[model samples]
Target: MGDDASLTARKAQLRKECLAARDGVGPLRRAMAGTRLYARLMGLRGRTIAGYLPIGSEANPTHAMRVLARDNRICVPVVTARGAPLRFREWWPDCPLEKGAFGVPVPTEGGWRVPDVLILPMVGFDAGGGRLGYGGGYYDRTLAGMGDALAVGFALEAQRVEAIPQERTDITLPYIITDAGVFGADGTV
Candidate 1:
């Protein structure tokens, strides 16, 4: 296999393993994780932040989004087109939503806005801030275009791996707030 192909295969295997681990977290643990994440995220205030609706076993950021909305502008990602950077639409706790691209819930009616902070879901990650997302590369493309937007990975601690296979397009996360604790850019709590 060529270098790129080999890397792709390695990442595919790791992604599968990491996702299983995330799913294995029982409801008790998942709830605990959600609580921890809500506490960790409370530190970010008065900023336009993008928080995603949880799909499957992805950690939910609804708690933080709700509280933050009182003081900050909250938005959610909308996949307007395939292979295009995601767009942010204004969101609220009770915003009318319809399943958008990929069956992810998106606001039905809201103006577009740029967020200063994006809370991204991670399929896997490494201590060096390497982020391994689902193969689509949406967050990578979005982050690249989002100048100065702080990217934070939201996941269970089970999602952390020894290393994440790197590609040129992979963007490093400044913070990964998992169930265990908040990890800094260097992967240290």
Candidate 2:
């Protein structure tokens, strides 16, 4: 197999393992973890932050977005097309949402906004902030477009791996927030 094939297989294995671990978490525990993540995220300073709605067993950040929206602008990514960077639109707790690509909820009506911070969902992450995502490359493309935005990953503690296979196009997150605590790109809490 070539490098691309090997990387694809590795990502597939990690995604399955991490997703199972996340799904095993009970509802109460998941809620508690969300609270912890929210607290840690509140420390970051950004006038406009982009977040995502929870899908499946993904860790939810809606709580934090709600609180942040009170004093700051909040936005969510809209999957406009395949093989393209996502477009972000202003979003609030009660903003109307419609199903977008991949059934992800996006704001029904809002102007385009660039965020100073972006909270991305992760399947797995390593000590060096290498992230294993769903392999769509959306976040990576989006980050590449926004050179100044802070890239943060929100995940459960169980999703941490020793290392992740990375390609040249991959973007590493500088910060990761979990139920346990906030971790730096080097994996130090």
Candidate 3:
């Protein structure tokens, strides 16, 4: 098979594995415990962070939410329009969030804000630190101007691969939190 075909098959298989793994929150907890992510994230000051609510088998952010809310200004992604960058809305554990377009939750009452730290979810990621979102380019465009924002992708060890298809517009994660450990762009474990 060609590269595209192989990638499609690999993604489908990995998606299934990830979903199963996320179904039980125990792994997420253990992963977070094994890594120094909590300490690192908790250290951020004056940071406006954006974290997405995990859907399907995507990297679960259930645990990260509590730490983030206590440490920094936490925001969530709200889908506004197709082909447009994502608009962020302030989010808290008890905050009322309505299911917006594309079935993702959006804050019911608040204006938008740009993120200083972006915590992204991935279906599959490569050892090269490339990301495969839910086939959306929203994060890529949103991070274009916010170069100062720290980009972090959360995923499972099973989702890590040798490489994934990437476009010129694709943005990479500087840090990745996983069940195994926190990895940098150089594939350091």
Residues 22-117 of candidate 3 have per-residue lDDT tens digits of 565565464663354565577786678888876665665756776778767888888788988888998888788778877776789766778888
Which residue segments of model 2 deviate by more than 4 Å? 43-46
lDDT of 3 at 138: 83
Per-residue lDDT of candidate 1, residues 1-189 (tens digit): 499899999999998999999989887767776777678767776889999998888988888789888888899999988999999999998999999988899999888989998999989988888889889999999999999988888888889999998888999998888778788887689
Better model by lDDT: candidate 1 vs candidate 2: 1
Query: What digit string (tens of lDDT, one per residue) describes model 2 on residues 64-118?
Result: 8998887788999999889999999999989999999998999998899999889
lDDT of each: 0.88, 0.87, 0.74
- Between 1 and 3, whose TM-score is larger? 1
What TM-score number comes out for model 1? 0.95
Model 1: per-residue Cα lDDT at residue 166 = 88
- Point out the worst 10-residue segment of candidate 3 by lDDT: 28-37
